[model samples]
Target: MWTAIAGGIQYIIDMGASVMLPIFVAILSIIVGVKPGKAIRSGLILGVGFVGLSLIVNLMNDQLGPAAEAMSQRFGLSLSIVDIGWPGMSPITWASELAIIAIPLAIAINVVMLLTKLTRVVNIDIWNIWHMAFTGVMAYAVTGNIWIGVLGTAVHAVIAYKLGDLMAPMMVDYYELDGLTVPHGTSSYLAPVAAVVDFIIDKIPGLNKIDFNADTLQEKVGVLGEPVVIGFILGAAIGFLGGYAPDQALPLGINMSAVMVLMPKVVKCIMDGLMPLSERAKKIMNEKFSGESFYIGMDPAILLGDSQVVTAGLIFIPITLLIAVLVPGNRVLPFADLATIGFFIAGAVAVHKGNLFRTLISGILIMTLTIWIANQTVDWVTAIGVTTGSIQAGSVIAALDQGGCPISYVFTQLFTMQNVTGLVVIGVLYAICMVFYVNLSKKRAAALEAEDDEE
Candidate 1:
C-alpha cells in the first residue's frame, strides 16, 4: 500500500516534468520556424490530452483499479476507479524521518568540506547545482525513505552552490564566461606556469602565514559590493604604514579604490535593474547576453580559445569527487568524471596539450555529454513499465492475489543479473551516444575542409 502511494506521487511529478519539457523545447524551437506562443499552446494541449489524462488514467486502471476491484469482491464494499484515486498506503513514517536528519548533517558536511579545501579550485555555477538537488529529490522518490531524499537533496544543493561555487572568487569569471570549462588559447599553455606559481606560494614560510583563504570569490564580491569592506581593508593597510607617514595626511587613495572595485556590481544591481525600463534595455541585454552563449562568456574579445579543458577540469574535480565518492563509493574516479575526459586524454597523449584545437574539441564534446545527461535525467520517471500474459483467469488469479514480486522488479532482473539494471542501461546508452557524436563531428569537419579548399 505504501509502495503504491509513493510510486503514484513520484509518477505524477515525473509526468508533470515531462509535460513541461515540450514547452521549454518549443520556446527554444521558436528560433527554428515555429511561432513561440502557438507552439507552446499546441504543445500544452497535446500534453494534457495524451499524457495528463490518457496515460495516467490507463496506468491507474492497470495498477490500482484491478487491486481495488479485487478488494471490493472480497470485503463486499463496492468502490469505483474515481472513488479510489490512487492505490497505495501513504508513507507517513518515511517522510517523518527525512526532516530530522537532512538539514544539520548536510550543513556539517558542507562546512567540513570548506575548511578542508575540497572545493577550493572549483568554479561553482547554477548547472552544477541543479544536479545535486535533482539527485536528492530522485533518491527519495526512488528509495521511499524521506530522510535519504532530504539528505541527498539539501546537502547536495547547499555545499554545491555555497562552498563549491559561492565562496570561490574564480566562480565569477568561470560562471560568467566558462563555468566548468577547460583553458584554451595561449592561456592553455600557461597552466603549467600557474601550477608552478601556486606551488611556490605554498612553500613561502612567512608568506604562508597569511592563510590564503581560497575565499577569493566571496572576498572579491564583498570588497567589490558596497565599498565599505574595501575601505576597511584599505584603512588597515594605511595604518600598517603608520611609521612612514607619522602625522601628515597619509589619507592615501582609499575611497577611490573602494568605488572602482564596486563599480561593476553596483551597475549590475542598480543600473542593470533600472535599464530594463530604460529606452536602451532591449539593446543592452541582447547585445550583452544573447550574442554569445552563457559558457562562452561576456565578450569574444577576451575569449581565450583554449581554456575550456582547464576550467572544466577544475570544476569537474568537485562534481567527480561527489558523484564517484558518494554514489558508488569509488573515490578514485578521475578524468573519466568529465564526460569527454577519456577522449581528450587519448587525443592529448596521441599528440600533446600543444594540440590546442583538438583539446578544445574534446572539451566541447565532454560538456555536451554533461548537458545531455542533465536533460535526460531532469524529468521525473513515474510509470514502472510492465507486461503480462495472463493464464486462465480462474487458475492464475490466486497467484497474483497473494503478495508477490513486482513485475517491474522481475523486468529489472531479466536485464541485469545484478542490482540496479536501470542505471547500468543508462550508462551504456550514454557511451554509445558519445561515440556516435564524435564520429559525426569528424565527418562534418572533413566535409567542411574539402569544400573550403575547392572554394
Candidate 2:
C-alpha cells in the first residue's frame, strides 16, 4: 500500500506543475467551502494558465538558449566543468531513495507547524519538494545514512516554511501579490541575503536616495519603456550579437515581447483561483484562532511576471558571462540556467522594494557568490549525478542553481564540517538579519491593522 501510494504521487509529480497544482487547488478549494463547480472551474483555469505560462517560457528558452550558447562561443567563454543546470540536477534529486519519502515528510511537517502555530504559511508548492529532497540526497551521499538524509530534508522544509512566513508581508506589499507567499527553494533561500544587502544599501548615502523602478522607467520612456518593448530590444540585441541577421532577429524579438505581455495575464488566472481560497482561509483563521492571519505559499514562477524582475534578469545575462571571464578561478559558464536569472533576483527585487538599480547591484553580488560556490561544489554535484545515474561515471556535471545556492552551500558546509568559519560568520549575519526581519514584519502588520481600523 505504501509503495503504491509513493508510485502514485511520483506519477502525478512527473506530470509536472501545470497538471498537479490545479488538482491540488481544486480539491483544497472544495474542502475550504468553495462550491464544487466553482472549485473545478478555478482549477481548470489555473491549470490552463500554467500551461500557457509554460509555453511562453519554452518559447523564450528556445529563442534565448541558442543565442546564449552562440554568445558563449563568440566570446570564447569556456569553463572546465560542464554546467548542466537544473534540468540535470532535478532528475538526480528525484531519483534518490529519499525522494519518495520526502513528499509525505515535508507535507506532515507543514501541517504540524501550522497546527502548532509555528508557521503561518501552508506551503502548497508541492512540486518543489524536490529541493528539500536534494538536500537530503546530498547529506546521504556524504554521511551514507538514510535517516540523516531524511532529517536534513525535514529540516530544510521547516526552514523554507519559516522563511516564507517571515517574508510574506514584503512579498505581498512589494509585488502586490495579495495573500500569497513564495516558498520555493531558490527564491525563499534568497530572502536572508537580500535583506542583509538591502539593509546595507539603506545605510549608504547616495544609494538610498535612488527610487528607480518599473513605473519610473515607464514614465521616463513612455511606451518605449514598456516591458514588451524592452523585451523586444533585448531579444533583438541578443539575437544580433549571436550573429542572427535581421530576418531571424525580428521574430525572436517578437517572441520575447509576447512573453512579457502574456506572462502577467497568466499570473492573473492563478491569482483568480487563489484569492477566493485565501479569503476563506483568512476568515476561518480569524474566527477559530482569534484573528490569526495566514498565507498560501506557492511557486515563485508567478513572481517573474513583474517587469522589474524580467529586466533585472535580462541585465544580469551579459553581466553573468562577464563575471565568468573577469572573476579569477571561476570555472562555470552559465548556460541552461541563463534564462532563470529572474529567480536569482526575485527576492532582491522585493528586498529593494522594486528598485531596479539596487536589485541589479545585489544580483551581481549574489551571482558572483553563486559562480564561486558552483565551482566549489562541482565534485559533489557530479558524484550525486553519477550515483543516481543521471550522468555517466566519467562525465562532468555541475548545477548553476543548486550548487550556487548560498543557503544550500552554507547548510551543507556547516553540517558536513567543511568551511566551519565561513558558515559560522554567515550564520551570525543571518541571525542579525532575522532580528531586523521580525521587527519589520511586526511594524507592517501593525500598520495594516491601523489602516483597516481607519477604513
Best by TM-score: 2
- lDDT of the candidates, in the order given: 0.30, 0.79
Deviating ranges (above 4 Å) for candidate 1: 1-106, 115-131, 154-267, 270-455
- Model 1 local distance difference test score: 0.30
lDDT of 1 by residue, 50-153 (tens): 34323322432343233323333444432211111111101111123332343344445544654564432222111122233333434454455555555554
Model 1 residue 266 lDDT score: 31
User: Model 2 over residues 74-162: C-alpha lDDT tens digits?
Assistant: 87887767676775677778887788999889999998998999998877778788888887787777667788788888878888888
List ranges where model 2 is wrong by over 4 Å: 418-443
Lowest summed lDDT across 10 adjacent residues in model 1 is found at 396-405
Model 1: how far residue 97 lies from native, Å: 11
Candidate 2, 199: how far from true, in Å? 1.8
